[model samples]
Target: MRRAFFYGWVIVATLFVVNFATHATGNMNLGLFVIPMSDEIGISRGLFGWLTTSRTLAAGLASIVIGRLVDRFGARILIPASALITGLGVIAIGSATNVVQLFVLFAVIGFGGLSPQGGGLLTSVPVAKWFVRKRGTAMAVTSMGLALGATTFVPVTQFLIGAVGWRRAWFYLGIISMTMIVPTALTFLRRQPEDMGLRPDGDADSRLGSGAAQRSEAADEAVWTLGTALSTRAFWMLTAALALGGFAAGGGVHRIPYWIDSGFDHDLVSLSISVHAASAATVMLAVGILLDRVPARFVAAGPFAGFSIAIVIMLSADSNTDMFASAVIWGMSAGTGIVSQPYLWASYFGRSFLGTIRGVTMPTILVATSLGAPAMGYVFDFRGSYDLAWQVVVAIYAAAFLIMVSVSPPRLGRPLAD
Candidate 1:
């Protein structure tokens, strides 16, 4: 396979491992600890959810810093540092005994190691750099690492938490982070293809007799910088749609607790989340390939519709089967969105500026995602049902879907003709 395989694929596989480990310790996995940690620490559900808010706030800030680092220094440094910080944070989580501890520790985790599954913008920049023609497929497949992490970690954490305790689960994850992710980041990762004497997608050397020195993509391709992209109406529209989508996706944090509260079995709730992640992982390759071949907006829009339908199903679910059904649909849609966002950026604006551009847009997405958990918790705390939060999520998804369908790529000098 080496004879025909792209080195970019090697980079992808390494990032897959890095993402799997980082995401396994992320807030999504914290859903498993909602009841245990809150009960043990003697905090309200709404208060516990605020810890997620703190974590998101921390990551949102860190993303901006890391974004500059990514563009300047590259993933080789950031990925490992993020992993180590995340590991220490996870290990420290076991020691948390109060809301203060929870807030600080989770914030640390957010800063050190949260990707929302692409290690925030760190992973996306590299993918944008390495695979232009196949960026969609590469991102789709690579993004599966998060779902796969969830698929594996959710069930394992459930068991570990059930057996030894949540504390031990965090401890075990920290060990894995240090041992696995640290080495992988150091050895398997590279900054970009050019350093290795290759071109994006390994494009042919225009000079036949010469070695792999390649032509630049274009001198006038008009990469959208942060300021220029911000000037466009398309930027705001995509931001609005994605922020809402992010808010809706935040449903993952409270998924276990929501089901458990609705008289659903604890084991079943865990299984539903695991199955959801698995379902998303299952279609990631297909979505990746589809993004390469289709109009990304068209591909992106279906998931938002699925998100709406899934919320409707959640509203009336009566059994574990119903919850699982809803999760599958939601997971598939979530999977599609993860891959499409990066593809859309690369395709629409060009790859040269992806790191900075993504950095600019990330805070809203992360903040919106943060809002979901606390909103669900607050509504449930007040109303004693998840009904209100789900209702709001449904509306957001509807609005997001409409906005996404209406958006077009930003042009170089155009301001707001839309």
Candidate 2:
């Protein structure tokens, strides 16, 4: 009975929809636009890559500001505004006539992609506040929407571009943003369970005296302030992992061009991304449930491992089958990144200040991500192949994997007397 009616689940459902729409038209989808834009505008691929870096820098900067706003104001105002702004930004991209215009517009998208309430810490932090015992499950379920969005949107957008053109395809994204996202945020999103007069995990107040309630409340108190959290060993360790996530997963991840260069047609390449997203969506739910039962470090190591192996596979692929296989493997690692990274924070430091913690850590994630696409693009321009760039990615993943496995529970900022 308790499983069916929790309002915390309402936040989960709402965020799932939010993430779905946000990511469907987000950075990941930028892959679909690259060839079309280059074909029409005839810009250097190396120059085209700067757009990803610019957007990453903008989003990183905005995350710091948005993090504070989220902690202070809650999702009530932030989420809706992000929807409108992000949707308009996407629409504007269709009208861009020059590289400067595209850069400016993508910056707008970077802001809206994960703002005070759109994605990342914004969504995860609130859900974290609303579910102590079920934090992993909640974040996992919410993020799965991105996988579903990517799964459907990539193929659909590909088809849209084929039928109508890339400009019309982007207009559809703007329409989707307004029609689907705004209502969901306004209808179901809340700052906390207390706003609706309920306890976290949605237990009845009548049970306040019960042992279960006491334990849940006690667990919630075991959290770190931003200052306290910063001083911990685990903070640096985990943040490092998240940073590498940008380079390994973030940099130059637009595999469409790489595949297109390898001889696959656009439609086949698009299907590979769909398979990747399908696998990612599958892993998010599975890993969420897995983290609830197993140690997070155990599950975390696998992402780096999968990523490294996938890069190796990409280097050897001579057929569409190999491309889909490697893409699917890459998707598995991405699932851990989007889903497990937050779970790691709440598990280690608790969620009381996740917004600020992730806010402070956001730039580290972005700066590395900012370098990734351009690095790959330049490498391709230099060598006419992604083999070397992908090999370099594998090496980084290897180091990150070792770092992840070496992690132990962080020593507290103020340890008890020996």
Q: lDDT by residue for model 1 over 109-212, one digit each (tens)?
A: 77763557222587777887788878887887678887898888888888889899988888987887677788887898887666666667866422322222
Deviation from truth (RMSD, Å), model 1: 3.7
* Candidate 2 per-residue C-alpha lDDT over 1-418 given as tens digits, one digit per residue, 9 for 90 to 100: 1545788898999989888887645556778899888888775677777887777778788888887777667776787787788888888888878899988987887786453222376678788778877788898999898888889888888888888899888988888867788888888888766555566787654334344443454455565678888887777887787677567766545588888888888888889888888899888888888887887876887888898877788878898888989989989888876788778777876655668777888888787777888888888889888788888888888888878777776645442221
Distance (Å) between predicted and true CA of 51, model 1?
0.8
Which residues of candidate 1, in runs, are more than 4 Å off? 1-3, 117-119, 205-221, 413-418
* Model 2 clash number: 3
Collision pairs in model 2: 251-372, 252-372, 252-373
Distance (Å) between predicted and true CA of 114, model 1?
Answer: 3.2
* Candidate 2, superposed: residue stretches over 4 Å from native: 1-4, 113-119, 206-219, 411-418
lDDT score, candidate 1: 0.77
